[model samples]
Structures are given as C-alpha cells and as structure tokens.
Target: MRRIFLVYALVLVLLSPAFSFAAGWRDGTYEGWSDAGPRSIQYAKVFIQDGEIAGVILREYTDRLVEKDWTCYDYPPFGEAARTLGTKFVEAQLAEIDAYTGATGSSTGWMQAVERALKKAGDAKKEKQYFDGTFLGRSEVADRGYYEVVWVTVENDKITGLQVQRVLADLSVLDPDTYEGFPLEMARQAYAQELIGRDNADVDAISGATGLMNMLNIAVRDALDRASTK
Candidate 1:
C-alpha cells in the first residue's frame, strides 16, 4: 500500500503543468505587487523585449477603486467616485506618460513596482533608442545613372513606415499604374509590414525580393545612421 501511494504521488507530480513553466516562458507574463494603497491592493504586469519593459498592464485593484459606494441627492462625485482611475494607465501607450490626477498616491505606488521590474529587466538587455523622423536613402542606379530611392520613418525607437521609388535620369518616378513587372508593389508592402514595430538594425532579407531588398537595406541603413548621428 505504501509503495502504491508513493508511485501515484510521483505520477501526479510529473504530470502537473507547473513543471512546464521553467522552459516555455521567454515572452511571458510577470506579476508585480505594490505595497497596498488605501483603497485596494494593486498588481501590475509588464511585457519586456530583449530585456526592457515594452508594455504594461494593470492586472488587479481593490473594491474602493472599482465601486462608488455612496449615493446622495443630485451627487455622484465624492469619496472614491471622484478618484482618478487605473484605466488611465492602461490606455496610455507608454508608461512614462503621466499620473492620474486624483490618484497620485496609487499611481506612484504602481510606478514604483513597475520601475523595480524594469530595473530587473534592464539587467537582461542593453538600452537602445532611435531618432524619430523621416529619412530618404538612395542607391545609385545601374551603370545607366538611374538610382532607387527609399524612405524610412522611425518613431519611438521603432520602424513605423517605409516607401520605395525607382527614379530615371529625368527624375520622374515610374508610374505604378502602368508597371506590372517585378512585383514592386508586393515587395514594398512586404517590407513595410515586416519592418514596422521592429528595431531598424533587426531587419532581415525578405525572400523573393533579394535585389530590391539589398537596395532597400542600403537606403534604410543610411537613413538610420543619419538619425543616430544627430
């Protein structure tokens, strides 16, 4: 009986999902708890990239922040009712933006925990930033002296947009309406979609568009280099 119990217990432990947590969570949720504020306990989750907090989600809050517990004659703005809510933080794209007006203490507590988590993450990755703006890059045309031009836009340290144009000696752009060769439109679409929301240095060569890919890379590299130097 004792041997059977031991074997069963071992089987149950081996099958549990907690064992999988060790290997599968590179991009995963991390929970942070604040020293409870007057209204409720606060919890936060931050998403990291390579090692920096790229995004944040406020996961839990107490009852006072959620409910307006009092009702009066023609009155709806007292107690927790008039407080600045946690929703403001979630709607904000960047955590550094601002603190809720009436909820200064809560916001400070929430940011304190998040800042601690960020410090922990910083140890995992080197910090990086990009110059935000639009840049034009050109690759010399073939021996015929025509060149390809590409525009790459960087904002908030990410590649947000790109455009490509092939120019002739007269500097007139080829009409996209009449051009059907080489899938330029498709290549352009692919480049823009794939490069957006990623670091400029992290772009990879797109398949089936090798030549244009190289040209685009040259233009983008020059553009990004110019941004960094400024």
Candidate 2:
C-alpha cells in the first residue's frame, strides 16, 4: 500500500504542469486587431471554452472600412489562407504556425491578431491586473446614422496608444484629413490626448463636437471594459 500511494503521488506530480497550462486560459470570446496599414486592417475574433480554443474568425478590411471579399478571383490566396489558418490554430492550439506560402502577409496578420486575442483571454488570477494587449470597441449608431470604432492599447496597466475611426452608413471610413472631417479630426486629437495614459474613460467632452465626443467616450469605455481584469 505504501508503494502504491507513492506511485499515485508521482503520477500526479507528472501531470500537474499540463493541468496548470490548460487552465491558464479564461473561457470567453476575445477580439483583436493588427496595426492598420495604409490599405487594410486585420481582425481576429477568438472563441475559447473549457479552456480550449473553440473557433477563430479572421477578417481583413480595406482602409475605407469595406471588408475584403476573399472569394473574389483576385484574392484567392488570401481566401485560402483565411480558411486554413484558423483551423490550423484551433488544431495546434497556438498562434505561431506555418504561414501559407502565397499568402504570407495575410497569414502573419491573422496570427498576430490571434496572439493578441489569446493574451486578452489569459487567466486573470494568474496574470496582471489588466491584460497588456490591443482591444477594439465600437459605439452604437448615433442619431447622425454614423458610428465610431476605437482601438485601445494597454501596457503595464496604462493606456499607451489609441486610434479612432468613424464609419459612415455606407461603410466608408471618414477621411480625417479632409475638410469635411475637420471636426472629427479635432475631436479625435482632443480625446486621445485626454484619455491616453489613463485607465478610465472619465475625460470631459470636447466642445462643438459633443456628439462625436460622446461616441468616442462610449467606444473607449467599451474597450477598457474588455481590457479589465475584473
């Protein structure tokens, strides 16, 4: 009986690491985005359940906020990459994997997005008070029939970076450099200055752009909520 008890204890010790590693993920859906290039932004939505990756949805959108139609003839490689990489990540349970040969760029972006999502889903009790990652959030459509999206970056529990985008009803992104976008540009700059380095969205609204400011506040708060450990 003493020998049998010692053997059982040894087995438990051998399996403990794997058990802890598997329990390091919190079950939830998390969304992340890659840095926006001049032409596009990559997005990943990861679903986790029972501490395992359940599914991944990958998407790329043009600079104008239009989703890329990977099914089109010109984008076959991207379509293939998107279809395969998600399954590969789900199977391997890791984001670092072999990239598709002809679609390396898309594969890299998707991988990065997935990595960020997993970071957000890290076990809260075992990790930092706030996840260090990029989180995306959006505001409900306002009375003007437009909405706002903001990407908030957190590092060391501080809001390190922010990018805001406004989408029109037609799905076109507002060009902040244009004359028509002057007000939005002003509001973006003001709110970014106010919110960066702060953990909360308790900044004051910008005058003359009250509606846009409200949308910005809503979006930022949504993002902070996702980044919170509590």
Candidate 3:
C-alpha cells in the first residue's frame, strides 16, 4: 500500500509542469506570444505593477475571407480587444473573466494569448526598450497581389519615422484601373505621419484605411520582432 502511494506521488511530480503557473506574480513586464496569422493568433505584452496589471498592448489582427474570387475580411463583432479584453483581464488578474463579449474563435484566441503571457510573467519578467535602429518589415497579402513593406526608424527606443514602399506584382493587374494604384501608398503615407514619436503602443489602424493598416501591422510587427531577436 505504501508503494502504491509513493508511485502515485511520483506520477504527480512528473506531471506538475502542465499545472505549474504563477499563482503569485512579481511586478514588471511580461510578453505573451502566439502563432502566426493575425486572425487566429495574437501577440500581447502586459505590464504588471504593484501586483495588478497596469497596461496591455496588442498587435494588429487580420480577418480574411475568399469572396467572389477575392480576398476580403470578415470583421469580427468587436474590432478592438486591447481596451476591452485587456481591461477585463487586468481586473480579474488570475480569475477567468467572461469572454470579452463572446467566445467566438477570435475572442477565445485573444483570451488564450493573454493567459500565455501571464503564465510566462512569473519566470522571465522583462521591461526592455526597443532596440534602436532602422528596420524593414514585409508581409504578403496572401491573394491581394501586393506586399506591404515598411521601413521604420527607431531612435532612443521610439519611432521617429516610417517610409512605406508598396511592391506591386504582375498579378496586381487583377484589379485594373490605374497602373499601380491598387494598393495605394497615400494611406500608408498618412499612417507614417501618425506613427511619429509613438511606440508600439499607438500602432492602431488608420481610420479610413484600416485594411491596409492591418496588413502593415503584420509587417511592422515582424520588423519589431526581428529587432528583439538581435
């Protein structure tokens, strides 16, 4: 009987990591990352202070669909999760909150991303600034026939400028009207104006051209992620 009890205890010890999590987290900053694809996966960075979550930041999310032989987005019910979801998570801390509006795939994915960040916060708490330099980011539009390229300048750990380069391919003619006006640069140029002096905190979608902004956000995120790697 004693041997059986000992063997059961050993099994629990071996499986502990699956249940291991920070019941009491220290204050600082923690990042939670998710898989690729803005629709399903979300990357989040959270700041904890005085044992309460102080701030939360999210990368742009994409919603894509194939309609009438074109790639388009099916905007989720709640377009922004940082303010709503983040606020709820911070309020609940370790307790689960009602799905931010609903448990649709996007909302569920957002919740999972937040949980991962919180779980990681216990061990690798960090509050590092962006690596200073200029970097390039690129993301393909899947079937949109163009790529969004952004050159971001970082100085003193903050964004100073953004130069956008729209690369149009032969397939760009799929939407013919102007020679290269399909993926307009004007929206990005305006967005560049908005990015000045902002950290990733302010990288929200441009009001009128949010579609382009969503695509650009992925590329911009890639650039920022690369800077972190180096």
Top candidate (lDDT): 2
Extract clashing residue pairs from model 2.
none
Question: Per-residue CA lDDT of candidate 3, range 100-141, in tens?
Answer: 554355455556556656665555543445545555566666
Lowest summed lDDT across 10 adjacent residues in model 2 is found at 16-25
Candidate closer to the true structure by lDDT (higher is better), 1 or 2: 2
Best by TM-score: 2
lDDT computed for candidate 1: 0.54
Error of 1 at 221 (Å): 0.8
Rank the models by TM-score, top first.
2, 1, 3
Please identify model 3 stretches exceeding 4 Å from their true place.
1-22, 37-40, 63-76, 80-82, 124-230
Order candidates by lDDT, high to low. Answer: 2, 3, 1
Write down the TM-score of every candidate.
Answer: 0.41, 0.68, 0.39
Of candidates 3 and 1, the better by TM-score:
1
Compared with the true structure, what per-residue lDDT tens digits does model 2 show for residues 1-230?
A: 99999999988977763353743778999886665555666788989988888899999877544588787838678889877788888887887889999988878878887877887787644355556777666788977777898888889888888888878888777777773744667778888998889888777867777777788888878777666654
Alpha-carbon RMSD to native, per candidate: 18.0, 4.6, 12.7
Local accuracy by lDDT, each model: 0.54, 0.77, 0.57
- Clash pairs, candidate 3, are none
Extract clashing residue pairs from model 1: 141-146, 141-147
Clashes of each: 2, 0, 0
